[model samples]
Target chain A: MERPELPLPQLHAFVVLAEELHFGRAATRLGIAQPPLSQQIRRLEGKVGYDLFSREPGRIGLTPAGRELLPAARHALTHLALGLTAAREVGSGRAGRLRIGFAASLALTVLPSLLRTFRERFPAVDLDIQEMTTTPQLAALRERTIDIGLLREPPAHDAELGFETVLMEPFVAVLPASHLLAGQRAVRVEQLADCPFVLLPRAVGPPLYDQITGLCIAAGFTPQVTQHAVEWQTICALVGTGLGVSLAPESIRRIRLKGVAFRRIEPSTVRTRVAVAWRKNDPSPLVPGILAALNQGPPGRP
Target chain B: MERPELPLPQLHAFVVLAEELHFGRAATRLGIAQPPLSQQIRRLEGKVGYDLFSREPGRIGLTPAGRELLPAARHALTHLALGLTAAREVGSGRAGRLRIGFAASLALTVLPSLLRTFRERFPAVDLDIQEMTTTPQLAALRERTIDIGLLREPPAHDAELGFETVLMEPFVAVLPASHLLAGQRAVRVEQLADCPFVLLPRAVGPPLYDQITGLCIAAGFTPQVTQHAVEWQTICALVGTGLGVSLAPESIRRIRLKGVAFRRIEPSTVRTRVAVAWRKNDPSPLVPGILAALNQGPPGRP
Candidate 1:
């Protein structure tokens, strides 16, 4: 006879029977009534095409077939338990991968500490980090191509996305140290109204680009654009050459470029916020652990 | 919060949800109503200490935590399925061990074909073979030390023991080829009643010893036992030296001892029945496959 498929429940029952040997005892262990257990055994026997137990007047004994199934049943149950444990470990963020998309600016600021803390806490978790802008990063999150994104504050999109603001820093003016206003502790936005400014293009980061231009508009004059740079390092280099002044996040002061002076903006409300974004409804087990690691108790908060 | 232990049901549910992000679709896939599915998701979230799904007005999406859990859940389910397959394979005798005890006589008889067939059918099964007498073989079966036995028919034991007769061969008279009666095709048991005999002691094989002694008694004269030997080869060698004549199972003729000739007994009812013995109620999965390999189709029958 063709052997029928062995279901997990039946294998589990068989293992219990092999352990107890008595139907009443096994039934008690399984939390089921004796008759039902007996019926299940009968069904198992029908599938196996043999009697697994011999029914004598006073005692029940395992037939040869039943003895052979004992080890296998135990093995299967053990593996099932192992699988559950694996899932739990992955869910707890003690294991598995965390794919992250990061903006280039974070490398000099929060990135090192964040990565170090995550590594120390979840050593087994593999981090897949990709440098991406806010828009593409959010798009990647929506498409499920990435698990988490670290970027500057972004324009609002679908409410299904979640962004946790982790850092906020005041804008600062970067100028050549030899410039006439370099000695000032702080530069007012209106004082440099006619200054030719080196800045990033809107296509590079639309939200931050608009925030800088809006600050210029707020100062009563549209600054003449002299140079455009894709990154902070390039803008700092141009400013050191006395090309023009550029508004940058306070965290950018760490660069310490030669001949470049960083002075706080008079209206410091022109600041940048960095946030972590993800699909609000993502059911990934690793995300919570990653979020916990990313959390630094509201860094740079006012 | 400490990570709670993940249960199998919850992990299974997580796998389903990871496949279908929408609660309604996941609930349908799980064969439950949406509310209970939501409850299960809530329970999973409680265990994980985070949200797995974003609760938006219309669309469902995986939270970072949920995305992290997806692959782990899938792996766990796949492992569970693999474990079940392993159990089934073992239960069907395609894997595991078969412990067997056998009498020395079968080595030259049915053992070769039996082992070859068993190996061809179940290459992964480990065979544990021990050479033993019928009494000890039966004892091993009772003690659950061995799964199968190939031995001479033994005396009745407890009802829990089972015996299946596989080989039956009439006894034959073995004598020196140069002896007066060696030229004869057949020798009457009554004629050899007064001849000197070389036979194994009763302690070695009581059942066979009693049968041989009873045959002499039936022929009306007791054979004078001239020598004793522990093994069939020793007895055959003694008979070859013309020390005496002996009656042995017909399969023994295959030995072809020098200076010894085997002749059929006039009354062939004096036969040896070699059978496979096992515990009647042994529940071992390997027994059925071994039994099938041993059934050699009614040996020496009309």
Candidate 2:
């Protein structure tokens, strides 16, 4: 309720710390850096607007408010841990349920084949999948609602979540099927210099968005953004409506919309990388299994 | 089991801090300095042989050991405060009770007069008195069992307990009734150089014992300590037996031993001062009342 947010990891930190009362042990239990664990508490105090512990020089104690807050905090954490276990149990469906979120383009390419190979390797494991952009996938991974995430342009700088690229593909030119250059084998990026573009919002995938804009910049012109859509299929449908042209991951070619044309971008150096990601502290067994499946073989339309 | 003992004030500190969870508020509640409060906790942790609180930079928590110790510590503290309350009630008999401890010699002098005036002012206040040495009196004061202490050569530097000098008297040379020095109205300290002395051990009253030795040294001799007694009356009776002569406060003359003679020390510069001591943070009404009454009159045989 106070500004940006109270991060959830800090809640876990509070409960463990309250029980242990020792910093070194609690940090070890939390599997986090000890220094960050302390910083997290200060930030949490800032969010809580009241301190949970009395940090006198030679002693530490719970204030009245802290004592009062203890039961509730314990309740939330215990229930959360329980819910995680229950959800984990139900999700796995005896074998295990792996909830996965992926970028729109990945669904058309890596998704089907990855699922096929994963089903072959672990047939009993249930696959619960959702279409998501890179931004929301990261959030889902952190919240632990999804055990694994398959998304494009994974944030390499984020140290809290682990990521491994599963696929890399160059940009393709997407235009209305009836466009004048639709029959060409490939088109130079500069050829679309005057065309209006349809693009995903930068917030959804900052790195990919920057790469697309950078490609246009390198080609000596900025494509006028005429519209936006979160899904590649929607972007293609909009392009099919003769709305605008756009440059996107090559995986967009697999969407198969009748009126949309995908052509290679000449000198196509701008590319998008799709990566699988998960919370670093995620305890789910399915996470590693899924990662293994993603790397077992080259994915394709089988 | 450890050396120097675990200070009890630290225990009180732990409970209050454990409850408040905030150093500033806990310090205010304890009526103690904030800086020392932290130091007290650290010392308490050392006594515990385990950290009771995790003092991470931005956070503080109780370790499992701390959590386990909480209930017991709370029990000890609650009962102590309650016992103190019950004792206070029984001591005062509805008005208020004041338990006092005094240096052994004061029982023969300042003790009786101070009690009479104090009783006169607060007629309903119950009086419980004990004759104890300075060291034990300090322990009793810290334990909160005794409301006030009347002792000699009080430690002026003790920051925890407040001291007010109530009476000061010069040393008297105590000797056998038939001794050569017994006929003199007064004697210089050097005159007792050859006599064996009866005195209280240094352990019972360090400063007083030091003063006696210091006075003898200043007079170019060290009175040989051939006998020791805790009470001045015993010292007088020992002197009566001709076992030894001793330097004592003038108040020792009031003991009226049959075979002992008391003569004022010539200079009178060497004196023993009796002080009323009480815990600074003591909340009882009788303590201040007794202090006022003690200051109200000049103590004497009356």
Backbone clashes, each candidate:
34, 33
- Candidate 2 chain A worst ten-residue window by lDDT: A1-10
Candidate 1: TM-score?
0.69
lDDT of 1: 0.76
Q: Model 2 over residues B1-302: C-alpha lDDT tens digits?
A: 00113344676677788877778788888887899999989997775565667664554655444554566555434443443333334333335567899877777677777888878877766789988889899999988778799888998678779998887788889989989999999999999998999999899889999999999999999879988988888888989999989998887777887999989887788778788899776655577788878878556541
Model 2 per-residue lDDT tens digits across residues A95-152: 5567888777777678888898788877767789998888888888877667788888
* Chain A alone, TM-score per model: 0.73, 0.67
Q: Candidate 1, residue A244: CA error in Å? A: 6.6
Model 2's alpha-carbon lDDT is: 0.75
Off-target runs (Cα >4 Å) in candidate 2 are: A1-302, B1-94
Q: What DockQ number belongs to candidate 2? A: 0.01
